[model samples]
Target: MAMRKLKHKQVPVWIRLRHLPVELWTVKGLSTVASGIGRPLYPDAITRACTRLDFAHVCVMLDVSSKLPKHIIIMMPKEEGGEITCKIDVEYEWLPPKCTSCMTLGHMAKVCAFTKPSNPAIPPVSVLFLKRYLQGHHPCSRLKGWTNRERDELPHGKTKREYRRLKGWTTSERDESISCRPKRRTTKERDESVLVKEG
Candidate 1:
């Protein structure tokens, strides 16, 4: 065990936190960051090594540099993981962009083989609206408010007229269509109808 400890101590590993907030250059903030980094890296879980914070940067020491993580999580005192928390967003030092489609890293889902290719026929905005918007289809604003006079002047009058007609479907028409549809018979109604027929 003594020999192993000596061998491990021979190699030194270090990491730097670049562009650290100027406000967090104080002793307390630096110590906290250092402690947080040290806890997971050390087998002993010693959190006392974050003593160095120099010029918007923090230098941390670790036992093994090869196993360094891509990113480090630091909790700020101002907010405790709330929506309004003042977060310190840091890019990973080594990890690539994650592909949510196949749940992998190093590439995005756009070129993922497991995912089906997006339909070329559909507009991107339409696809986004379909995913995000819960309400029924809404015509684009330019297609809306197209007056009959404007439609006559435009070369695509037939298409405009059809679109306007479709959009002009009234609440009365919706109600009429709904009333015209057959209603499902409830269990009680079915039983009552059977009894009446027997009577």
Candidate 2:
């Protein structure tokens, strides 16, 4: 049997709250603190029983696009009518892969279909391949000198024939452009050329 792929943007996640004050162990207090991360669902069995003083486990309905903060600051009212600040640490048991481009769950931003270039002239390259190529790892590193803006105008992951056809460049023009680039000279050859120039 085939099952349909479900796109889950919002999910219930179990988060551990650390450094929680003794007074905030109640249901009301736990909900208030958990609300900082997401809509508070309910606390775990241990949390409800107050059997564990180390941390409180609460299930929250979290949105994939919500910012995951390491720590959250909470203000508590003191007996003297002033407020005291408390810092709570948050820990997620697990998180699903999220796509920042589409702001959805189950996929990462790099492989996001929405981020793929719409123009057929620019063949789509994997984010990892494009990153490495830009860093001079690819054999076609000659194109490394081109800025991102310029590279956006060029066809990537295409053969020379395809590139020529896409850019409407003739063989002579392509050869001329290739020849215009400065050739790499060895250290010894460069020194000899310098000595000859000085002579």
Candidate 3:
């Protein structure tokens, strides 16, 4: 076993938070990001777990507004035969699961995926997003093409008037026909009625 004294620096943001509202999660080892670029000499598993990064290795400054812990610990490569464990300590905002059923995050009862009618807990919002992702159908607001109205005019969206137009229907002449006085009906019907009364 080799141990060397490394230089430690005070945290940057810690000095600023005089005490607003914070729950710190302290881990005891360096992140996999550190070792991936240069090996911390820990192991493989540690590298995989700690190096789970999103947004192109950009340090995502998590918002601490959620009612979750504000700290996290990252584990390093586990030593063979379970001897050495590299614990990475991280201090940041943790978004705790506001959901009581699954204890997950960014979800409500209406949108949890893990929830079933019988054994339901989490909201189904996650499921909805998943379905939309799989279907590859985005809302009209998100689309970039001509737009819903234009697309509707093209083929898919057909209303009564639109359907009629597709069927080659035009304005009917009968609909525009006008009523005339008929020249007082030639006065013949009136004369005939008078003769019948005389008979």
- The numbered model that scores best in lDDT is 2
The model with the greatest TM-score is 2
- Relative to the unseen true structure, what is the C-alpha lDDT of residue 31 in candidate 2, on a scale of 0 to 100? 95
* Residue 26's lDDT in candidate 3: 15
What are the TM-scores, per candidate, against the unseen true structure? Answer: 0.26, 0.55, 0.16
Instruction: Please identify which of the two predictions, 2 or 3, would achieve the higher TM-score against the true structure.
Output: 2
User: lDDT values of the candidates?
Assistant: 0.41, 0.75, 0.31
* Model 3 per-residue lDDT tens digits across residues 46-83: 22354432211212322223332333333433446443
Query: Tens-digit lDDT track for model 2 on 62-158?
Result: 9887798889899999998999999999999998888988888888998887787676495876987677555543333444563222322324553
Candidate 2 wrong stretches, greater than 4 Å: 1-7, 117-199
What's the TM for model 1? 0.26
Write the number of the candidate with greater lDDT, choosing between 1 and 3.
1
Q: Which pairs clash (backbone N, Cα, C closer than 3 Å) in model 1?
A: none
Candidate 3's C-alpha runs over 4 A off are: 1-84, 100-104, 107-199
lDDT of 1 by residue, 1-199 (tens): 4552122311222444554555565557656555544432321112234354332233444333234454446544545554432334332223345556655444577877668656657645676566323222342322344332343323323322322222233224444331223456667655554211111
In candidate 2, the residue pairs with backbone N, CA or C atoms under 3 Å apart (3 or more residues apart, or in different chains) clash, namely none
